[model samples]
Target: MSVPGAMIRCMDLTRFFADVDAQPWADLHHAYGSAADIPDCLRALAGESEEAASEAISELYGSILHQGSVYGATARAVPYLARLAGAGYRTEDLLVLLGGIAEGGADEGDSEEAACRAAVVGQLPLILAKADAEDPGLRRAAAWAAAMTGAAEQVLPVLRLRRKTETDPGVRAELLGAMAHLDPPGTAADATAAIGAHEPAEVRIVALLACVDGGLPWGPAHHAAMLSLLPVNDLVEGRLDLERNEPLQYVVEELLRRDTDADRDAAYTLLDGALRSADSEARAEALWAAETACLLSRSAPERLAGAVEAMVADPADAPAAYSLLAKLGVRAAAAAPVLARLAAGEGDPADRALEALVAVAPDRAAPLLARDLGRRPRALGAACGFLFGGAAGASFTYDPELLDAIRTRLAEAGGPGADEVVRLVNLLGAWGSRASAALPELSAVLSLCPGAVPKALVAICPPEHRGTTAELLTAAARTGPEEGRLAAAAAVRELTGETGPLRAAVAARLTPGGPAVREAASLAAGLGPEAVALVPALRSALSDRAGDRNIPQMDADVEIAAALWRITGDPEEAVPVLAGVLAEVQPMWLRWTFGRAARAAARIGGAARPLVPALEGLLTEPMQIPSAVLALHAIAPETLDGPRTAGLLLDAAEQDADAETALDALVVLGPDSLTEDGRRRLIALAERDLRVRASGLEPGIAPADERLREQAREAARTPAKP
Candidate 1:
């Protein structure tokens, strides 16, 4: 009869009473018959007289509890009897029955419940005796049962049997699988000893698979077994089959898919080998898997430090190495000396290493680059370029003393690094707000290197230097060759305002023949009222043929759009212009330009309202999601209500879902709504789904849905664990 879940104790008692009138003697006893069928005949009686049925069942269970203590059959059934007795029966009676079962009579061994209890309390002697019983069935049951009871003492017996006549392959495999459930300290050593005692390849494979499944710390024995398994053969295939059994496959797959510290660290050294397999899809899968592991490990300081160490040791992986260093950020301070050493080298890898170093320890790295200021100018130029390159520049800031030191270095006698010095000058103009004292020195350098100065002056020279810089830039653009005039025009176009000096400078650069003249005129047209005089010139450039570097249409678009917005006080003019160019735009700069235009429209009232729905749709794209969410957050944070967002989150948390995107969305949505009941449900979901999704992830990086399982564990604890 099926027990109703409403109250197991009450139902069991009721079943026993209903069967009292004509209790079947259990005459049809198979080796292991179901204990359930006996109560069937009393089903009608049980419904009519519930109290009478309960009493009869209780009495039967009590008698069974008594029988279980003194007979072999009862010993096998004692755990169930004990459970029945404990449901509503007296606690003292249950304890007494348990004691009697443990102190078995001459014929019967300890009851299974008593043996399991003994295992739980570290009484290994009792379990060892049962495991060495004359009957193989009893030995197997005891060994396996004790394993489930979390006893470590049976590990040795399991190993010893493998060494003896382990003739039955299935029996031997079962024993190895059982060993995987044990977590004792010396289990690996015991498995290794068994492997050594048996010279057969099957035995060795079983031993190695046992060690892997054990998931213990890697000791000498584990190392030996792994090395032996490295060479693939029939034996290796067999061993891998054992390791990839349903349970282990699930565990390894779950571990490989998450971004957890343990998952990342464990797989770091294995991924490269997986990638180099002669399989293209395998290489892609392995690369992505390892990348997932690294992302998960980013928050772990120790793992991040380890990754930095690996990068230093292997400079050949410069791109991957640099990206890892960037992820480490300031936490990788320990890698500073290594970065300094690498920056001192001349190889291209050395340049990459320096960039990675600067990314992590920018303040410290600036000094190293500064100390080697007089080294190879090409390397120096590359270093300075990386320091301020659009890609790596935002990753760091110049410490005050470091910028000062660079300024002082620029004042020193010149060399092949002069181009780099000019680059630094441009950086100061762009970001050197605190380097006011260096302006005189910058002006001196510009004057001394007139040709070099104007090339970068628009980006470097401040307004105080603008008038003088403009004079120099204008004179150079008019008097020098095509390149010099382009540099001058580019410099003068950076300063905004419709002042007399700016107008004169733009006029001088717009002599109307070269690309330099057209670019200057286009920029002048966009510089608001300052560029109103260049309307005719800008229109003329739009019709002119393109050159290698000039963008006549784009330049004219930006200029005309800027001038129209300033003159008419309308932001819509810029939106349509950008919208027209959207299809042909590259991702690298498109969104940034669009964002700027949108922000400008926002400032000029609701000119950007029409684009809100378009921006909202971008939230589902992986790369664009963050920006879209941020924009929405700014516009309407309250729209992400608990019920709606939590439902979205739950959908993402499903096993078939995209885990990385789910995690990202969860981080944005927040977990405020994951209440106690919700957590319990999540745990139940994880338990149901873990078997399927476990194979796709790394071991340590389990799904967030599993948090419910962790909560269930916490709830069931009595005193509560720390």
Candidate 2:
């Protein structure tokens, strides 16, 4: 456990971490406050003693790098650990632990992460040599680590040789799964041999999953064969006792959908048995599989609906059935009649059923909900479910009669059920156009429910009624309930579209100790250029509220920065804060910052150049890439280079996932942006109509016309024309 031994072998460790004897413990962090104690754990892991090493690996596995997220001290710890693995460090899960660290820090786009992998790669020769260790365990561990570090080409040859002579079924199966990644010509054949191997059930399960993942999960016979071999220990992470929990038909239903050409007759035979089974687990899985996998036999929907209809008598089973039906949304329209009965039931069950009815068949359930709202204990929520609470629920607009019904109830149902009236009034505010006739009643609630009046009034009042709305909201912003005051201020700003009165209102609540700081900032953001008057207040609020999460729908810090930029028209004012957020070492959890920061950075131009390294690292993720790509070209257009950026723009355009940002990047990148290689691939992709701007409205696929040709024409307008 002496420091000199590890230091002598891996001298580069001193760059990021302290030595054991002189550890500056107070300054480091390892996802658990102050990592000063980490050096002892590292030393114990380095020692030759097995018991000490076991305890060390267990304690430090997640701490050094928590679930693939790296901390400051994580990179420093990698070299010493790699040295231990290279020098024959022993433990059953040591290779698994090391493999996590290697891949956890595998983000090569960032310098700190690149350094960790670089250190591991330097020790590859030593790690690879361990595959021939006298102990079979060490050899297995070494092979696992090599594959994780992408020494696949190097590791697979050694693994193949070991598989030929290895007697341990567990080790041989592990070798086959590892080899599946590189997928040389005959991986499917090798996987089949492993599946047919006389090994532990867990080992064979590993081989089946590897075969599927290796893109060779062939025909229906293999699909049924894999199902027959289900309930394996490794497949479910040793959590469920699959032998007792798994029913035969449930197994076949799960694996049926995963295969492209699974036998329909065999699948239906198992599913029919599952539907008839007494086991709820089997029956439910079969129903869900039929829906998700597009495996509707002629009788599937009727059998499923009839089963749900029968279950409506049992309150306990009905809600869950309704919830499962809701998973398919409008596709489960066949279950509407049954769902409506449950929606008319009592309490939580009714709420869930109402939600499911909206999802399953909004149009059919609409009149039922409209009539029931006046009588239910929570009428407002039922209305929300039909309005926009469930996915696709918004498309089911209220009938004018429904609006009149809600309006009449809002006024008549005032006194003891004022909260109900309040909720109805709030709905009227949000459904402005649909419920515009409900405004006179919303204004009437001003005296009835003063707390909910201001926002509702501002949000729903006719434009001619602005004078009355401004008066009500101004008073609410000054002295109403804390929740209503902020809502009032926001409504006032949005209603007036003039910042003077809204600014005065928000300013009254923008004090350091005030509860409306976040709302005030939001109002400031919406004010645009008019918010310049509140800069000092925003800056002060941001300082005191650095970690504040009170503001929903946006990150508080990012909003404050964005507000500052909009108000000042000075990129210098906001760029620093946006850059700081963009440059976070672990920005994965702070994804809310990506789009906000990217939009701000794209406006700031050269001010964002220094954060280029941080921005580039986000390219690995699909969700964050569009914004990151925008920030990249905004700061340094030259970094985008050739076809990859061009192709990404085309792909994002076709997908419409983040086409606006991609289109913006193309603009910053200028004309003739793609290199010849990118242009070639792009044209081919568009030829498949993958980059069509408008899907043909008339009928057949869109021809490679002007709109399609433009994608390959202007860099910004360039369709990825194939």
Candidate 3:
């Protein structure tokens, strides 16, 4: 077959390096293992089928850049890969690989990333030429790659020109985005001008965001303008992507900004009408606005209660409404009767309603909960589901008699013969050490509920029962599936602070293995420094294993990296891997990504400074903002002084979802970092926190806000301390 421009370019790439078939790949290392497979992966991309190309890209991503950390082989491969990209063979995937590789290896763990990025950047012109390629997809991808790898100064002009001539809205958006990356506008006027310019919503939105990224002022006018761009038809039909919600979210956050009374009142009016809107999108967004207002005490909580409860009537909408209600705490007490009635119904609404009701109307909910618990022996599973179903349920005050009755019921129920029995047993397990009274009952069903049983036993056992718990854990470890065994290992480690017996199991599981490796890695992670002996094994597990035909869980490398950090106390060893994991996971923003790896990096204290960049990447994610800021402040306090980080925290504190976490990070920054804009941000955060408390919510974490405020003040007074 006659080679296309892409394959010819790829053929030229071979000259930049050893023949793919000739390279001694086994000696060269990647995240998972040797680099030998990389050549195969590289060759696989030259194949005709998309599947082969995709598989090759996937393998490359997994091995060379597992999660996000770059390996030695990755750096070696970039120049040749860039040539392939320049030639336009599998350009999008190549760019993705290049981008991922470029984002990594800045740390000691993955030392090759920096060199690889520089090499790739050196090939910028070839990749940039694709911006003018006849293929629009390649043009779009090339623009993104420029943003990801190429110099902003060199790429910006090209992007601007492309924006002028681009007919494709998507391509235009990408150009504007790439431009934004190069020199984002840095003032309210520039942002307004950029957004108000003749451009598609995607381009305009990117421009506004770029302005924020550029440390621009974003005030009520900007807020109002962003919201105004939301065409009504799109909102009602849910035609817009998740990105479109960013502007609406900003409007909701307008309450937290230091704005005029007129703006505040106008925002309230705008939000209130939206709250009343029948369209789910509008109402949902309005509810978010109302929650922030309520939390800030800028708007009355009651104003949004009816809308929330009405929204809750639909099962699909209930989870979100219940989440707000959970935040509302007792402020939504007036909705208690409504919640209780809803809980009496069935499925998700019942579970969420019960959880929310327990928070707002505990006294009112107790009887309803008691009724459900005793309603029928078969209803026991659903009843347990109601109590332990949502996150808020952990805080629910259980009636002593009901607890006693459930224990008694479980004792009489014997082994879990049904799915419901397994669930009930799991709930009893979740009750933890406080529910130790149910241990005997739980142990009886150990075989039936292998996964939950050992965890429960270890969690709930008294100090006196530690040996007994260890015994049971060992037994479970020997008897259950890989997950069950790991769970048992983690549990036993917790109680005994010993890893000797589990070391063999850990080594056996933490290898080039299957899906079960994830569970094993998680257990090792949870074991903390106690699993020190498994460090080498963990490192081996993290290596590329393309030869192995096993599908590991997503972010498996992250868990192993986190465990390595916790166990070894070696930031140089752990931080880069954690950062890599963060790089890999942050773009996805999965709820689970905020788990051990991020926490490990945060707790590693000052030595995890290398991870600051990775942590900062997550600052834009509302769910991740708190963790990101907290990690930043803990690892490198001085870094946040720069506008972008501080501005991000300030923005985070403005939102209801992230307020507590944002405040937590601010407090951690102490008074020194809290002065000036930092001080104002902390003050606003404190005020918002106080408003949440004053709203009569549970105040579970916010009362600590004042203490945090005082700590900052103390730091201010001390001034002598660094």
**Candidate that would win on lDDT:** 3
Better of 1 and 3 by TM-score: 3
Model 3 lDDT tens row, 177-239? 566555655223444666764766655665555555555555555555555554332321221
Candidate 2 backbone collisions, by pair: 25-36, 683-721, 683-722, 684-722, 711-718, 711-719, 712-719
Worst ten-residue run, lDDT, model 3? 235-244
Q: RMSD in angstroms, all models?
A: 24.3, 9.9, 12.1
Overlapping backbone residue pairs in candidate 2 total 7
Could you give candidate 1's per-residue lDDT for residues 1-722 as a string of tens digits? Answer: 23554266565755556444243336422124433433442342234465755564544344433443333333433443344333424322333333344433222245455543542334333444444544454444444444544444545565456426655443354455456556533456655565553545444655655554455433445334433433323443422233343222222244444434454334444444443444443333443444444433323333335445544454443345454454455666766667667776776656666666665676666666666555534334433434333332223465566566667777777632556666566546544446565666665565445545554455445567677766666665566454445555556555433244445555555543444554554445446664566555444433233332224444445444544455455656555553443323345545444443333333333454554565555444333443444344444555445434444444544443433333344444445644445455445444442322333323223333244344333422312112
Ten-residue segment with the worst summed lDDT in candidate 2?
696-705
Per-residue CA lDDT of candidate 2, range 1-722, in tens? 36775567456445524544475555867778777777778777756587997888777866776767656666666656665565445533555566665666663666656655655566677766777777766766666666667666666788788778877655665566567655633466776666654655555665665555555534554455445553333343431112212333334433453432344444545444444445555455555554433221222343345344443445555554664465445556656777787777766666667766765676656666566666553434544533233222134456666677777776674433676766666656556556667777776666567666666676567778787777777676667656566666666767776556678776766665456665677678778887777888877665433453332323555667777877887767576776666655454566656766676676666766766887787776555677878777778878876467766776665554454455556555554566555556445534432223333221111222234345544542343333
Candidate 3 segments exceeding 4 Å error: 1-24, 105-110, 186-191, 228-278, 282-316, 374-395, 398-408, 411-722
Task: Provide the TM-score for each candidate, comma-separated.
Answer: 0.40, 0.60, 0.55
